[model samples]
Target: MSADTSSRSSRQDAFDPFLQPELFEGVRSRRIIAFIIDAFVITLLTLGASILVFILGVFTLGLGFLLYAILPVSVALIYAAFTLGGPSASTIGMRAMGLEMRLWYGAKPYPLLAAVHLLLFWFSISLLTPFVLLVSLFSDRKRLLHDLILGTVVINSAYHRAYTREHSAAA
Candidate 1:
């Protein structure tokens, strides 16, 4: 390969967990914390949505009961779509934990990808909780089953920020 092609390939290889484990340093622990924070935030949002649904049901002669039943799921979907689909590719919890999700190629996922990622995550958790968790333990990237399926990885935002700063300075 030419020198230019070799340089480009090396840059791409830097993101491969097997080639450079540092790219995913501390990701497993941070991901767990981020999950906890996201769950708490989702719960609070669902609760508020449930209350609104209840009030509306009172006015609709109890028809809001159906809405109340799905309020939690709906709230979670909206929150994940809006936050994870943003430029940061992270939810509020992920941001708080200084983590972000990116495609395997290091690109931010679009809104649709984020929503699908969330759906796949919930599905995997519901059907294969133990297996899903175990999958990450065996992977060099520390990626869960859903992440693998979606071709995405969760990375430390702080590390990315530092790398960006250093690279920009060099440039």
Candidate 2:
């Protein structure tokens, strides 16, 4: 279902896991795998950034080397902001895994929200460790704590277009 942009409605009326089980199929597992892929991508990005910093340090006599301290987190947030917040509403890794993220009512998340989603995820992991993922185990929609807090849900991109206007009209 699309966002209820036609009018205001409670989030309770949003996508329901019970009603759209297909959307969440294998999501819990896919999410973990996706994270691995994204982490690898981020590592590569950080390495590239490190190279640039190294060159800059040479020019500045090591002043730029200080960037190394924040390079990883900076790359991660910028990566998530552009990819997850882009038109696809999924990161490169998430797209590879056939996953996408949507707001509770089915609208795509904007750049800022996507970035915050990542920050919240990091914050949760920092406070509770990776064990925070256990929250999804009990969630009907298989949403992690960051998702719940952001009112977002992850779903299989394979079915993303299945409920589009054309399909609904055909039905």
Candidate 3:
């Protein structure tokens, strides 16, 4: 590479999560708590959906009962995707845990990116379970496989909020 290209590459490398541990402080523990909270939220939503489906099914002469096959999963996915992909880039759980997801470069994710991130996370967790959590133990960013694959990071919300305030002040 040319000198300029080499310099830019080196700068990027310096910003790598593996090289900068501060960015990921407390993320591992917070992530676990966030998952628990999110699961509870999804469960509540699914239960509510199930009740609604049952009522509708009864009124519809049992036709609505067919929805039971799909309601829970659909409700969970929709809730997860919408909340995680929203402007806040956090689910209710993550918010409660004071965490948020962002691009590796520290930009807030758009809704689609957020949804895909959650989808990838679920896929990885389903496939690897314990192994996925183990991967975070070795990562400097405390990132699981899906986070690494998607070029994203979960960081302390206080850091993000401070950064936002500083930038807004500068602007």
Candidate 4:
């Protein structure tokens, strides 16, 4: 008898949770929680960077003012890029909050893509003033400006059924 192609494909899809369309539903709340966590982390980083810049400025007799302009943006971009590129696909705060980053239509994005994603996020939020966030409200995927650009999505890891499967497998 010929192989049952439909069942075979279904089985394959089941084996790969990342490819499941339904796995991404209800992503908005997860993204909100993740953003809160990320915001805290960013705040701490910004505070530390500011202190360091202040010290440097004092030591340099005022050249530190120049450093202030770029430090926050630089810190945010570097941290975001590396975190998105890493295995967790999220910053430490996001992990602590049980969230993860994935592509809007597919799997985890590559580091290079994720970095660009982070950059776009920062630029829009920093430059657009208010309109940048409107995309999240109107976009079908509930993506912010950067998410739209990079096709990335942030979801709640705690409630994710896929997490259970992976956790069980690891155990």
User: Which one is best on lDDT?
Assistant: 2
lDDT of 1 by residue, 1-171 (tens): 999999777756546776556668888888889889999999999888888888999999998788966787788888888899898899998999889998877788888898899899999999998999999889888999999898888888888778868988999
Tell me how candidate 3 scores on lDDT: 0.81
Candidate 4's residue-wise lDDT over 1-171, tens digit each?
347877565544432334543445666666667768877887889889999999999999999869888887778777777887777787776777666787654366677876688777768878995787677678655667777666677766655546667878999
Q: Return the lDDT, model 4, position 107.
A: 64
Q: What is the C-alpha RMSD of each candidate to the true structure, in Å?
A: 2.7, 3.3, 3.3, 5.7
Q: Which is the winner by lDDT between candidate 3 and candidate 4?
A: 3
Q: lDDT per model, in order?
A: 0.86, 0.90, 0.81, 0.70
| Candidate 1 lDDT | 0.86
lDDT of 3 by residue, 72-129 (tens): 7687778866887777888998999888887766667777777677778879989999
Per-residue CA lDDT of model 2 for 39-104, tens digit only, reads 999999999999999999899998999999999999999999999999999998899999999999
Evaluated at residue 2, the lDDT of candidate 1 is: 100
TM-score against truth, every candidate: 0.87, 0.90, 0.82, 0.65
What ranges in model 2 sit over 4 Å off? Answer: 1-6, 10-12, 165-171
Better of 1 and 3 by TM-score: 1
**Candidate closer to the true structure by TM-score (higher is better), 1 or 2:** 2
TM-score of 1: 0.87
Candidate 1 segments exceeding 4 Å error: 1-14, 18-20
